[model samples]
Target chain A: MTVPISYYVVLSGLIFLIGLVGVLTRRNIIIILLSIELMLNATNINFVAFSAYLGNLSGQVFVFFALTVAAAEVAVGLAIIIALYRHTPSINVDDFRLLKW
Target chain B: MDSLIFFYFAGIILVTATLVVALRNPIYSALSLLVMFFHVAGLYVTLHAEFLAAIQIIVYAGAILVLYLFVVMLLNVKREERIHRQSLVAVLLGATLLTEAALLVFQSKGPVFPDATSSGSAGEVTGNTESIGQVLYSTYLFPFEVASLILLVAMVGAVILSKKGLLDQKS
Candidate 1:
C-alpha cells in the first residue's frame, strides 16, 4: 500500500514548525527570509499531498499560484534587504530598531 | 517498499530543513536548503506530481536559491549572534503548536480521499503535465493572469527599491 496521508501531514507540520521557530528566533534577516521560504515549502508539501490523495488538480493549481507569489516575495524582500543594508551596512535584525519601541 | 522510500525522503527533508535554520553561515544555510529542495522534488515524484517535481528543482534550486546566494555574497553578511532574545518563548510556543498538530492528525480516522495510486479515474488517464496544463490554462485562467500581474509589479518594485539614489533624486 501507499503511504498514508497522515504521514505527509505530520511531516509537513514538523517542517512548518521548524520554519516558524526559525523565523521567530533567528537574528539574521537573510536567515529569516530563508525560514519564510521553509514555511512556504511546508505549505506547498501539504497542498501537493492533498492534491494527489484527492484526485484533484485544483490543489496543484493553487501550488502554482503559491510559487508565483513566493518568487515575487523573495524578489521584493531581497531588494528591501539590500536597501536596508546600504543605509546601515548591517543585516542583523537587532540593528533595525527604529520601528521597535 | 513505498513507505521505505517515503521515510528516506522525509528524514532527509526534516534534517536539511533544520540545518537550513541552524547553520551559522548564510551560504551553508542556503546550500542545505538546496539539498532540501532536491529531496522535496523526489517526494513530489513519489506522489505522482512529476511536473511539480521538475518545477521544484528548476525554480527553487536553480533560480531562487541562486538569487539568495548572490545577495549573500553581495552583502558579505557575517555570522550572526547566538539567537534572538525571545527564543525561549518562541521555542515553547512552537512545541505547543507541534503537539496540537500531532494530536489532530492522529485523531482523525484517515484522509477522506482515496490514495493516488489506488484511484484510477478522472485526471489519472492523462499524463500529469497535460492535465495540469489544461486546467491551469482554462479553469484557472483568471488567477493565472493575476499571478503574472503580481510578478510584473514585484519586478518593478524590486528595481525601484534597489536602485541607487532614486528616492534621493525625487526629494
Candidate 2:
C-alpha cells in the first residue's frame, strides 16, 4: 500500500507534539535543547514533505535555512549549558532562578 | 513503495526519540537521540530529499549528536539523580501522551507528514534541486544572509561569555 501526503503531515504533527511535551516537561537543560532540535526537525520534515508532495521547492529551501539555524542554535545553546554547569554544577532548568533580576 | 519505508523509520524515530527524552540517564538519552536522528534521515530518504538526508546524517548524527554525548559525559551528571521527577503519576502521564501520538499517526491519512495546503488543482510540480536553488538564492537570499550573520554573532558571544565566566571564577 502506498502512503499519501496526509500521512506525512500527521506524522509530522505527532512527532512535533512529542517534542513539545519534552520541552514542556523536561528539567535538564541539555534535554530541553535536544527537544527544541526535535521540534525544529519536525518542522523541517513538514516543509520537505510539502515540498515533495506539492511539487514546490520552497519547503526544501526552508529546510536548508532551518538546518543552518539549528547548527547555530546548538552551538550557542551548548555554550550556555556549559556556563550554567560551571556555575552551579547542575544543568537542570529549575536551577536558573537568577533570571528574575 | 515509499510509504512503507517512511512508516518503518518514523516508528523507530518516534520510539527512540521517546527514549531520548524519557530515559533517566543523560548519556543514554543522547545516544537514543542519535538513533532518532538516523531514523529521521531515513524519513528524508523517503521524501526524496537526498541532499537533506545526507546533511542530516552527517551534521546531526555525526557532529551534533557526538558533541551532545560528549557534553553529557563531561557533565558527569549522576545516573541515579533525583533531579528529574520520578513519580508514578508522571510515568503514567508520559505513557498516555505517547499513546495519543501513536494513535494520531495510525489514523492519519497519508505519509508521516504533509503540507496540508489544500491545493485544489492537480498537476506537475517543481520539487527539485534546481528550482529550490533558484528560489533560495533569489527570493530567500536576504533572510539567508541575515541568518548567517546572526550565527556569527552568536558564535562570538558564546566564546566571550565562556572566557568571562572563567575569568570571574579565578578570583
Candidate 3:
C-alpha cells in the first residue's frame, strides 16, 4: 500500500504546471498570488516525499523554512496589493501599467 | 489500503489546487486554497512527517488563509476580470514542462529509493518531532535564526506598505 516516490514527484510537477498556467493566464493579481502559493505547496509535497523515502530529516526541515518564508511573502505581497489598489482602485494585472513608459 | 488512502488525499489535493486557480471569485479561490492546504497536510501525515503536517495545518490553513481572506475583504473589489484566453506561448511552455517531468520520472536511472540508514537513525530517535528538533537546533540553528529574522523584517515591511501615509492629504 506504500506509494512510490515517483508518484509524488509527478503529482507535484502537475500541480506546479497548473499553478504556472494560472500565473501566466490569469489577470487578477490575487489569483496570481494564490497560484504562487499552490506552487510552493507542490514543492512542499516533493520535499516531504523525499524525506520519507530517504529516511532523512533534512527535507522536512527545509519545508519548515519554506513555510516560514511563504508566510512572510504573503504578508508583504498582500500589503503591496492593498497599497496598489488604493491608487488605481483595481486588482486587475492588466490595469497595472505604471511602468509602461 | 494505504495506497487507496494516498490516492484519496492526492486526488483531493490536485482537484482543489486546480479549483484554487480556476475559480474566478477571489473569495471562492481562497476557500478552495484552504481545502488544498488541509489535504496537503494529510499527505504529510502519510509521509510520516507528523510535525510538518501539524505546521501545515496551523500555519497555512489557519494563519496564512486568514490573511488572504482579510485581503479579499479589505480590497472589496467586486468585478472580477474576464478570463483571458490561454495564449499559445503559455500552452507551449506548459506542455514542455510536463514532458520534461514525465521523462524524469520514467527514464531516470539507478535506485529510486535511497538507503534506509540515512533515515534509520530518525526512527531510533523518540519521534519525528524530536528527531527534527535535534537537527534544527544543532546543525541548522543559524538558518533557523535567519528564518525568524526574515519573518520579523516581513512584518515590518507589511506594516510600512499598508499603513496610511502622511504624504496624502486625506486620511
Candidate 4:
C-alpha cells in the first residue's frame, strides 16, 4: 500500500514550521529567502500529495504554476538583494532599517 | 516496501531541511537546501508524479539554486554571528505550530482519501507528462500564458533593478 495521506501532511507541516522558524530567526537575507523557498516547497508537497491521492491532474497543474511563480519570485528577490548589497556593505537584515520607525 | 521508501525519503528531507536552517554559513545552507530539493523530487517520484519530479530538479535545483549561489558569491557575505533577538519567541512559536499539526494528523481517522490504484482512470492510460500537458494547454491555457508573462516581467525587473544608477538616473 502507498503511504498514508496524513503522513504527507505531517511532513509538509513540519517542513513549513522549519521554514517559518528560519525566516524568523535568521539574520542573513539570503537565508531568509531560502526559508521562503522551504515554505513554498512544503505547500507544493501538499498539493502533489493531494493530487495523487485524488487522481486529479489539477493539483499538478497548480504546482506547475506555483513553480513558475517561484522562479519569478527568485529572480526579482535576488535582484533586489543585489541592489541592497550594493548600497550596504553588510547583507544583514538589521542593517536595512531605513524603513523602520 | 512503499512506506519504507517513504520513510527513507522523508527522513533525509527533514534532516537536510533542518540543515538548511541550522547551518551558519550561507553556502552550507544552500548546499543542504539542494539536497533537500533532490529528496523532494524523489518523494514526487514515489507519489507517481514523474513529470513534476523532473521539473522539480530542472527548475528548483538547476535554475533557482544557481541564482542563489551567484548572488551569495557576488555579495561575498560573511557568516552571521548572531541570530534575531527574538529567536526564543520564534522557537516557541514553531514548537506550538508543530505540536498542533502533529495532534491534528494523529487525531484524524484512517484513509480519508480515495484509493488511486482502485480508480483506474485516465492517468493510468496515458503517461503522466502527456496528461499534464493536455490539461495545462487546455484548461489552464490562460494561466499558462499568465505565467509566461510573469516570467517576462520578472526578467525585465531584474535587469532594471540590478542596473547601476538606473532608477537614480530617472529621479
Candidate 5:
C-alpha cells in the first residue's frame, strides 16, 4: 500500500498530543522543553505534508521562518533558564512563582 | 514500499518522543528527543518539501536539538530520583491525554489527502520553489525582512543576558 499524506498528519497529531501531554503533566523544565521541541516538529511535518498535498510552496517557506523563530526562541529561552537556575540552583519551573500579583 | 518507509520513520519519531517525555533521566530524554527530531526530518522528505526537509535537519536536528543536549550536559542533574516525582495531578492529566488520543484514533479516517494532484505524481505535486521565491521576494518580502531583524534582536538579547554578570565579576 502506498503511503498517503494522512499517515503523516495522523502521526503529527498523535505526536503533538503526546507533547502536549508532557507539557501539561511533567514538572521537569528540561522535559517540558523537549516536549515543546516535539510539538514544533509535529507542526513542521504537518506543514510539509500539507504543502506537498496541496501543491503549494508557501508551507515550505513558512517552515523556513518557523525554523528560524524556533532557533531564536530556544537560544533565548535556555539563557533565561540558566539565569533562573543560577538564582535558585534548580530548574523546577513551578518554583518560578515569585510574581504573586 | 513508500508506506513501509513512512511508517518506519513515523514509529521511530513517536516512540522516541515518548521516551523523551516519559524517562525520568533528563539527559536520556534529551538524547531521545534528538532522535525524534531526525525522524521528523525524514517525514518532511517524504512529503516532497525538499527545502523544508533539509532545514528540518540543519536547523532543528543540527542546531536547536544540540543546544538542548548541551544544556542537559551542563545541568548535571542530581542522580537522585527525588526530582519531579510524578504527582497525582500528573497522573490525572496523563489519563486525559490517553482519552484524547483514543478519540482521535476513532474519529480519524486514514490518509486525508488523496495522491491526486495537478502533476498526477505525488512527488512532483508540490515543486513550489519558484512561487515561494516570488512571494518571498515580493508580497511577503517586508515580513521576511522584518523577521530577520527580529531574529537579530533576539540573538543580541541572548548574548546580553548571558554576559550580564561576567563583566561585574571581572571588574
Candidate 6:
C-alpha cells in the first residue's frame, strides 16, 4: 500500500517550481519570504520521503536541522523586512535600492 | 489506499501553495500557506515520520504561519501595489527547473536503496524520534550545538537590525 518514491519526488519538484515562480515574480518581500518557506518545505518532503523509503533516520534528522535554520531565517528576514519598510515605507522588492550604486 | 491518500494530500498542498503565491492579499496568502503546511504534515504522516510530522505542525503550522500572519498584520499592507513585473521570466525559470526534475525522476530507477526496508538495528528504539535522537546526541552532537549557536547569533542580529534609534544613539 506504500506509495512509490517517484510520486513523492514529482510532487516535491512541482512544489519547488511553484515556490521558485513565486520568488521570482512576486514583488512583495513578505510573499517572497513565504515562497522561500514553500521551497524549504518541498525540500523537507524530499528528505522525509527518502528517509522513509531508505529506512534511514538521518534524513529526518537533517529535516530537524533544516527546520531550525528555517525558523531562524524567517525571524531575521522578517526583522530586516520590517526595518526596510520603516526606512522606505514600502516592502516591494524594487524599492530596495539602497545597495544599488 | 496509501497512494490515494498521498495524492489527495499532495493535490491540496500544491493547490494551496499556488494560492499562497497568486493571491493579491497578503492575509489570503498567509491563510493558504497555513493550509499548505497542514497538507505537508499529512504527507509526513504517510512517510511514517510521525515525529517530524508533529514537529512540522507545531513549528511550521503553528509558529511559522502565525509569525507570517503577525507580520502581515503589522505591515498593514493594504494590497499588492502592482502586478508581477517578472512573470514571464519566472515562468521560464520555473519551467527549466521542472524539466530538470522530470528528467531526473524518469532517469532514476527507483529509491536509492532499493532493498532497504528499515535499518532494523534500531529495534531497541520505539520510534523514529528515538532513533534520530540516538544519532543526534552522539555523532551529530557538535553540529547540533553549532546550530544552537547559529540561532543565538541570528536572534541577536535580528534584534539589532530591527531596533530603532540604537544605531543613531551610538553614533
lDDT of 3 by residue, A1-101 (tens): 16767788878987888898789888889989999999999999999888787767888889999999999999999999988887778999889887799
For model 4, residues A1-101, the per-residue Cα lDDT tens digits are 46878789889988998898788788899999999999999999999988887778888899999999999999999999888777777888988988788
lDDT of 2 by residue, A15-86 (tens): 787788788777877888888888888898888777767656677888888888888888778887887777
lDDT preference between candidates 3 and 4, better one: 4
lDDT of 2: 0.76
Give all TM-scores, in the order shown.
0.92, 0.81, 0.91, 0.93, 0.84, 0.89
DockQ of 4: 0.71
For candidate 6, the chain B TM-score comes to: 0.80
| Clash count, one per candidate | 0, 11, 1, 0, 0, 0
lDDT string, candidate 6, B136-170, tens digits: 89878998998999899889988998899643454
| lDDT (tens digit, per residue) of candidate 2 on B1-171 | 666687798888789878867887778888888888888888877776777788889988887778788788889877343445555777788789879868976786544433434443331334445666788889999988998898898789678766646635653
Which parts of model 6 have CA positions greater than 4 angstroms off?
B81-112, B115-127, B166-171
Over 4 Å off in model 2, which ranges? B79-128, B164-171
Lowest lDDT sum, 10 consecutive residues, model 3 chain B, at: B118-127
DockQ of each candidate, alpha-carbon based: 0.69, 0.46, 0.67, 0.71, 0.54, 0.61
Candidate 5 C-alpha lDDT tens digits along A1-101: 25666676778888898898788777778788888878887887888777777666677777777777888889888887776676667776767777667
The pairs that clash in candidate 5 are none
Question: What's the lDDT for candidate 5?
Answer: 0.75
Go through the candidates in order and give each one's C-alpha lDDT.
Answer: 0.88, 0.76, 0.85, 0.88, 0.75, 0.83
Q: Candidate 3 on B132-166: residue-level lDDT in tens?
A: 99989998999999999999999999999888762
On a 0 to 100 scale, what is the lDDT of residue A7 in model 2? Answer: 67
lDDT of 6 at B161: 89
Q: Which runs in model 5 stand beyond 4 Å of their true positions?
A: B79-115, B118-132, B166-171
- Fnat per candidate: 0.74, 0.44, 0.75, 0.76, 0.57, 0.60
lDDT of 5 by residue, B1-171 (tens): 888889899889889988987888888887888788777777766766666666677877788878887887887765433335566777788789789868987897655555644434434646455666775787678879978987898899788767657434533
